[model samples]
Target: MIESARNLDALKRRLASLDRVVRTRHAHFPFGHAPLDRMLGGGLARGRVHEFFACEGGEAAATGLSLILARLAGPQATTLWLRPSAAARQGVPYGPGLTALGVDPAHLLIGVMQDEGMLLRAAVEALRSPALGALLLEIRGRAPQLDLTASRRLTLAAEQSGVTALLLRLDADPTASAADTRWRVGAAPSVPLPGNAPGMSAFDLTLLRHRGGRDGVAWRLIWDNERGLFGDGRDERDDHGRQGEGREGGAPLSRASLSFPAVRPAADRAA
Candidate 1:
C-alpha cells in the first residue's frame, strides 16, 4: 500500500509538470458592446472558465446569454454542452430558436448526464479536448460537486486545450471557484420593433467578479441576432427603425414586462 501511494504521488507530480508546460496563451473575444468590451479590456478572455448565475425569474436570460457567449467563443468550432438529465423537465434547446439567436444548432452537441457527478466529469473531459472550441456546463441549483478543486481541474484543462469553458448556474448562488469571471444575468426589456414585435434579445448583466479587472458593474445589452453580436442598451433608432449610433447615458429602458422563455422543448413544433 505504501509503494502504491508513492507511485500515485509521483504520477501526480508528473501530471502537474505537464500541465505547467502545456499552458496556452489565452485569447479574448469582443462582446461588441463598446463599454462592456472596453471594461473587459477588449473582451472576455478565452481558454478560461467563466461562471454565470441566474437571478430569480431570469433563468432563461442567463441561459440565453451563456449560449450566445459559447457561440461567440467558438464560432467555427463545435460546442459541447453538458447538463444533468433532470434539466430535461425544464426544457431542451429548441433548434429553430437557437438558429434565430445566431447559433447554429447543428454545431452544438448536447450531453445529458445521469447526475451532477457524471455531468461534471464529462465537462472536465470535454474541456480537455482541443477539438472542442467551447464547453458549457449547466448545473442547476447549488452544485456541490463543482467545488474549488473541480473548478481548478476544469480551468487547467481549458488552459491546456485552449477551449473556453462556461458554467451556467441556474437557481444557484455563487461559491468559491477558479473561474476567471463571474456574472449575474437577468432579463431586460427589449427594444420594441416597428409593430410592437420583439426587437431583439436583451439581458441585464452584472459583472459580479472579474479575476484581474473591475467588478460590480452592470450593463444592459441587446443581442442582435442578425449581426450575432451585442449592443449597448441605447435607443439608437433611425427613420427606418434601424440601429444608429449609440450614445452613452441614454434613457434606461422600462423594466422587462414581457417574459422571455430561456429554453424551449426540442419537440415543440411551434418553435
Candidate 2:
C-alpha cells in the first residue's frame, strides 16, 4: 500500500508540473470534449484560468457550457457557482441541467451575490485553497473594472495552490476581461437524426483565444438533451475535437429539427 501510494504521488507530481495542465489538465477530471482535450494538449490547464464570455443576448450557449464545466469537475474537485443572475439560478433550470451533465448538485456550491466585487472576492477565496477543482462565476452584464493587480495576484496564488478558475460571463462585453484564455460558445445543431429528422440542440464551441493554438473555425458538437450528453458529430470516427483542415471554413448549416425556446439576453438582476 505504501509503495502504491508513493507511485501515485510521483505520477501526480508529473501531472502537476504540466505548464498547461495546471490550467486545464488534471488527473481527477476529463476534458469536456475529447477533441477539445487534444487542442488543450490534455484538457483545461489545471490551476489556470479560462474566461468564457457569452456576448449573445440569451444563454443559447449555456446548456452546452454547463456540460463542459461538469466534465471538468472531477469527483474530488468542487464547482463553485458564484453570483448567478436570476435567470441563470431561478429562471433557467441549471441544477437539473447540470445534473444531466453528470454533475451532482451536492457537489456544487452556488452563491447568489449582489455585486461583481463579491464575486471577485469569492474567486480569491476559492483560489486560496488548493482543494477546489474549478470555480464557475456567472456574471450579470458586469463592467470590466476589476483590479488587474488583484487578478494577477490571484493567478499566482492559483499556481501555488493548484486550482482552475473559470469565469462565465453572460451578456457581458467581450473586451471586459484580462484572463489567461478566453472563449465563446453558441448553440448549434445537436445530433442529426437517422434520416431526414432534424438534429437536437447541440453546441458550437468557438475558441476565441488560447495560449498557443490556431484561431478561427469553431468546432461543431452535438448535444444529447435526454441523456445530458454531448455528441461528437454526424461522423462517428472523430469523437475527439480535431479541426478538419481541408473542410471549408463556412460549411453549410443544416437546419435543426427540434424547436428549442429562444434564449433572452443575459441581464443583471442577480442576488
Candidate 3:
C-alpha cells in the first residue's frame, strides 16, 4: 500500500509539471497591431521577460507600456511592482494616477527594497509566486543585478510560474539582455480634441530587439486607457488626409523609416 501511495504522488508531480509546460506553450497576449503582431509571430509571449526602455523625452511612455500590459493580464489579475526605496520615494503610483493610467490601484502591490540585491531577490521571489499575475521591476539605469545571468534566472522563474515579467530600465541605454523582447518607447504629442482638450497619450514604440524576430521596427500608437489597448492614429491624419509621417496608412514603420539605429543611440549627425 505504501509503494502504491508513493507512485501516486510521483504521478501527481509529473502531471503538474506537464500542466505548466502546456500552459506556457500556449500563453500569449496580442498587441492588437497587425504588423507588430505579425513581426512578433502572433503576440507577446507570456511567461517571458520583456524589457522597456525610454528614449529622449519618453520616460512616461515606458511606464505606459508596462501599465498597458498589466491591463491586458485581466481585471482580476494582480501585479507585483518591485523597485528600490529610492525610486519609490521619487514618485510612487498613487490611486488617482493609477486610475488615470487605467490600472486598478487595488490590484497593484508596491514593494520597496533598499538596494539592487534586495530588489532583485524580491523580484525573483514574487515572480515565482503563481498567484501574482505580472511582475514589474524598475531598474535605475543599469542595476548591477539586472545582468544577463540574473535576467535569465528571472525568465526561468517567470516561465515556470507562467507569469509575465517586465523590466523597466529608466534613463539607460539599451544593452544585450536575456529578455525575449526589447522596446524603446518615446513620447508623441497627443492629438488635440474639440475645444482644444488633450487627447489620449501617444507613443512612438521602436522594437529594438527580439529573440526570433526582426528588429528596428517602429509604430506610432495612442493609448486608450479606458479600453486598455493601443490605437493606430487612424482618426487623426495629416492635412493631406494621408496617414501620417514615418508610417504608411496606419501601419508600423519599417526599420528604414525609423532612421535611428536600434540597440544603441545614433552617433552625432553633425560629427
Write candidate 3's Cα lDDT for 129-152 as tens digits.
666668788888667667888988
Instruction: Name the runs in model 1 displaced over 4 angstroms.
Output: 1-26, 232-262, 265-271
TM-score of 1: 0.80
Model 1 residue 108 lDDT score: 73
lDDT of 1: 0.73
The clash numbers for all candidates, in the given order, read 1, 15, 0
Error of 3 at 124 (Å): 0.8
Better of 1 and 3 by lDDT: 1
The 10-residue segment of model 1 with minimum total lDDT is: 1-10
Candidate 2: residue 32 lDDT (0-100): 40
Query: Could you tell me every candidate's TM-score relative to the true structure?
Result: 0.80, 0.66, 0.76
What residue runs in model 3 are displaced by over 4 Å at the alpha carbon? Answer: 1-26, 232-271
State the weakest 10-residue window (summed lDDT) of model 2: 1-10
By lDDT: ranked, best first: 1, 3, 2
Best by lDDT: 1
Off by over 4 Å in 2: 1-35, 58-60, 63-67, 84-94, 176-178, 190-201, 223-271
lDDT (0 to 1) per candidate: 0.73, 0.53, 0.65
- lDDT of each residue in 1-271, candidate 1, tens digit only: 0011012234233223322223335479889887778888878898899999998988888888898899888875667777777776557776566766777776676776777887777777767666666888899887898999999999999887788999999989999999999999888766567678866777778888999898876766778777778873452322122223243444433433223444776465353
Residue clash pairs of candidate 1:
60-262
What TM-score does candidate 2 reach? Answer: 0.66
